[model samples]
Target chain A: MQDIYEDILRLAAGKIRQRIRAGDYASHTAGLGKGKLQANIAVMPERYALDFMRFCQRNPKPCPLVGVSDSGNPNMFTLGQDVDIRTDVPSYFLYEHGTFSREIHDITTLWQSDFVAFALGCSFTFEHALMRAGFSLWHIENDKTVPMFRSNIETVAAGPFSGPMVVSMRAINKSRIQEVIAISRKFPLAHGAPVHWGDPSEIGIKNIDTPDWGDASPVTDDQVPVFWACGVTPQVAIEQARLPICITHKPGYMLITDVDDDAEIPVIAHSNS
Target chain B: MQDIYEDILRLAAGKIRQRIRAGDYASHTAGLGKGKLQANIAVMPERYALDFMRFCQRNPKPCPLVGVSDSGNPNMFTLGQDVDIRTDVPSYFLYEHGTFSREIHDITTLWQSDFVAFALGCSFTFEHALMRAGFSLWHIENDKTVPMFRSNIETVAAGPFSGPMVVSMRAINKSRIQEVIAISRKFPLAHGAPVHWGDPSEIGIKNIDTPDWGDASPVTDDQVPVFWACGVTPQVAIEQARLPICITHKPGYMLITDVDDDAEIPVIAHSNS
Candidate 1:
């Protein structure tokens, strides 16, 4: 078989949408597209559009927005030319009255005329940058989800969307802290920089053995549990709002976007490039 | 006359609320409480709270938030021992339908059950810091409001609150840009750090002489027109929302809180203290 990333990249977004639409691919999308950008998707009613947009606005550390769609449009033209939200992600969680009802591969059957789709910046993009800068990602190496925890930090509230912030924890050797900070600061949209570093108790994380989401990793005496605002925060807020209907990408089955990783990096452009 | 600041601080938050409740003081409160933390105020309807909060979040460089209230509460106890939204500000602007209508000293008569008050970090706090750091402020020396302009930089929008960012312009000698940045960053809540320094047109001010708000200052040949996100952006957003009744501190008049200025400086606290 061809390299998974190359095969995935060659596959048109529409084909990916079709596979997801067909309920054939339900696995998380880690290391699938190599350099391609994957996004966290939030689908909500138009009535919640502004407030939800604000929630992402105030909570950019976790919800750096990549693109916002016009009302009821399934096509996220900005993210990809032929992107259709209803059939994009491999799996999605449907929330009704704030309770998880079931999982589905496609939302085409549930599409609403007043729905708005928001594609948020994800930490996965910066993980590549960190790797390029020589920082090892244990989660990718182990094929496990990044450990995430609910922090004591309160998100600036938006209407119907208020909850504790969710942050992803990474164990980094004490010596590499400055390098990680320097490398991550360059990608502000990808949860920008770590929100909290060192003693987990300081940010309200009680146990390292368990996490709010994803698999937990152990921290050695010389390692610090560095935490960055996670993109999953909006999903938690959506659950709390208890809106009539809400949909979000399944944990790691993100919406692959055409927005190039280099384009999103914040450094000044070189003239020759 | 006795120092106005001493009188204001001597009045407990409850007594000040009583005076504001009685409509006794109807003037700007700048320089009225030398050691206390004063904040720019914005009160909006519950429906617009989330987007407005996001606006502050997205544009923290210009709109550092100090305190946010629960829906329907005029009491900003988090800010002080007994701060009351209905009466503390020396002056308030009442906007209906997103247009300025009238200025008043208190909102006791127009208080709504769903109103939420946000106390923003103000420039005055950082201005005090800048002065202490040995930098000169032209507006303070000449007794005029800081020059403000509507920048071409569009604020990261959340919901119904989307518009150009407004910036307060200050002239600093070329040698002092780094010093200003170091000093100003200590008050992130008070519009920490300059957004742009050097060229006025770079951020999209066409004619630097004519400002969108406040008076203009002459930039000497060696001085740069440094810009910081202004608190006025929220005022502009509230006007844009056009809610039936929105209130904010009248330009220059602020709400004095029991917060000690020395206590709130962003410096890491000394272990012994």
Candidate 2:
């Protein structure tokens, strides 16, 4: 059963990678590549790579690093054998001195010898875990991006990288919050458990209906707003850092890696049994 | 009941701080300030602060940073309001270019304007939790330092900071492994969960009775060796970095903070309840 599941995931990843490499599927990869781990890509010059890596380390909940490529290396060997950082993602956003410059399908021409690539765990992994556990995400069902907000929580700063933590909100049924947390906590790479639940104001979300990014999902009276550290957090910090040049996966468009969503957490050996 | 418990903890902290500040007690702080979180102290010049901070961020299991002080600041407000980094720790180990110079009771005179202090969550917190959960530790019972070894696991390297991960070993009864993991996972700041178990050879341990640091305890046939990310990891990295000057709390002489070992894990609000 597990092998069959993995075979299907490999097939999905192969098809998606081919489409992304051919510049065919350039839209958000929200529901694509089922059961495969999707990553948020950040590429920067080697000079800033160390600081950025530190930034990801300092703010892990917001930027859980899954894999890092050597400086000037486009291959993320740990993430996948054939994973190429330059053209694996569906779309890329270019930043100049932290300012949004333009979007592109490939960075083969723009790739530099000093460039370093980082693959950070995205919320999509945990969202898949939550869905598999039988909890429904309203945003996915409604065909909208998960609502994200700039929370008052401050990320631990590293070098020029520092900013408020950004969080993605989901309206979960009150009864299933524990199950949602249990399943999501297993995937620490994907933001882990929700940072804040119940009252959004506790984490500095002034208005739940109006989010700073993504489509806002309305919360029913039977549900509470639960927030997880968002991958957009690193992007916000990158903009604040204002590096000479930065390349990131455009919002919603992510790098689908060969890692299984369920593989991050290792099985504990049952000594008692 | 809760208020009374906190009051007792505050009182314990005050007494420990007074003794540590007055130079009346200058030794390992183990078994002192019960229920209060103890931290491994790392102090270095501001020039190397960013990289060190990143180092802690990248290698969290070995270096879980709980609080960081501004450069040249002696006060760690986040760790404790009255906590003075210079005098709070029982003993300080001065390192010059990665070489241990000597141990001192206070670093007040050596303190510089470029100095920065970092408080890393120590294993004492989780050990206390485990003890409270009815688990017995062989090292604690025998009044010896926990056995620590250099592992094959290489920590994610940052600028001037990189080394093999060091881990502490504890033998646990076969029946208590799950309970031990469950309790430790709640304290992510204190190395979280075991990195490996069963065989020492799996993580590069050549001899079970010999350790790179600390006293080794034999694992009985009924017990399995459980390894956790050790605080010594950063110390090894610092030695490798060879900064001009670095100050750290001597082994077992930790900085006891006002934060509760159990307080870091916030209780998730059960909406159903």
- Comparing to the true complex, what docking class would candidate 1 get? incorrect
Per-residue CA lDDT of model 2 for B1-273, tens digit only, reads 444334434458767787779976676667678777888989999778766765665566898877677667687765665778889888999999999999999999999998888888889989988988888999999989899999998886766888899999999999889988888887777989888888999989999899999998989999999999999999999999999999999989899877777652311121010
Model 1: per-residue Cα lDDT over B1-273, one tens digit each: 245445755665445656665676556666656766778888888777756765665566667666666667777755665667787787888888888889877688799888878888788888998898888899999988888999988766656776778999999999989999878866656877788888788999998888888988888999988999888887777777677878888888887776666543211111000
Q: Which predicted model would earn the best TM-score? A: 2
Q: Count the backbone clashes (under 3 Å) in each candidate.
A: 7, 0
Which residue pairs of candidate 2 clash? none
* DockQ of all candidate complexes: 0.08, 0.14
Find the candidate with the highest lDDT and give its number.
2
DockQ of 1: 0.08
Weakest 10 consecutive residues of candidate 1 chain B by summed lDDT: B264-273
Q: What is the lDDT of candidate 2?
A: 0.80
